[model samples]
Structures are given as structure tokens and as C-alpha cells.
Target: MKATTMKTLTVSLTPHQAAMMQGAVESGGYASNSEIVRDALRLWEQREEIRQMELARLKRAYDEGMASGEGREVSADTLLKELKAEARSSG
Candidate 1:
């Protein structure tokens, strides 16, 4: 496959970060500094997406529990038994 065309971009970073990026580029695994930045940005974007999905799942569960109108009862034994059952099933 043909390699992609390169473009110039300017960014600011701390000295340590710059050193790390320069080291990565000098390792010869990345074609340029831009390649390293692009890879990191892609990974960050993917992780952000996963975080958003998890947040949405938690929100849905909370809303469902609220809608169920279950009275709040904090019996420690009951909670422990239910938690153990769930852990057993999951693990």
C-alpha cells in the first residue's frame, strides 16, 4: 500500500513530553512525530468512547432502579448474600 501524504502541524508540550515524543520518533518505529501523536490521539479517542458507553450504561441502570420503586432497605446480611450470589455467577 502507498504511504499516506504528510502534513505539518505545530503543538506545544512540556519539556519532558517533548523528550518522550522525540525518543519515540528516534526509535525508528514511527515515521515522524505526527505519526506518534496521531496514534496516541486515536487511542485516547477510543478510550473516551468506552468511558462514555460505560457512563450511559450506569445511567440506564440507575434510572431503571429508580423507576422500579423498590423501597430502600439496608439489611447487611441480605446485601452480603445478594452480592455473593452475583459474584459467584459472574466469576
Candidate 2:
């Protein structure tokens, strides 16, 4: 097993937040406030990673759409009629 170095930092929290952390420890759900903070940080990191992936996927889609070429304007009635005709033929 690899040995990990730990660093300590002071953090200030609101009264409600402090009570919530303390309650979590008292409830036996967490061993200490630091553990709760570490767990919360892990969740936050996961969420950030997912958000980044979604942004990249959207960017790729936008690039593909732009590469497909310019779009033409079509009238709604004409488009609808054409769609209905195609559907009828396919069906």
C-alpha cells in the first residue's frame, strides 16, 4: 500500500452547516467532520466530471451539424405535406 500525506486546513461554516456536520458524526453515519467533507468533495468532483463530459458531447454534436453544410429554408405546409406523403409511401 502507498502511504498518503495529509494536509490540514481551517474552514469556516455557517451555524446550520456546522450543526449538520456534527449531527452526521453523532449519527454514526460518518466517523468525523473531515470524513464528511472528503465524501462531499468526492461527490462534487464526480458531478464536475460528468458536466465536462456533457459539454464535450454537445460541442462535438454542434461541430458535426456545422460540417454537414448550410441548411435550406422550407415552408411548414410544404414540409408537412412532403413528410405525410413519404410516411404514407413507406407505410
Q: Which stretches of candidate 2 lie over 4 Å from their true place?
A: 74-91
Error of 2 at 10 (Å): 1.6
Each prediction's whole-model lDDT (CA): 0.91, 0.97
Q: What TM value does model 1 have?
A: 0.73
lDDT of 2 by residue, 22-81 (tens): 999999999999999999999999999999999999999999999999988999999999
Model 2 clash tally?
0
lDDT of 1 by residue, 15-35 (tens): 999898889889887888888
Least lDDT summed over 10 consecutive residues: which range in candidate 1? 27-36
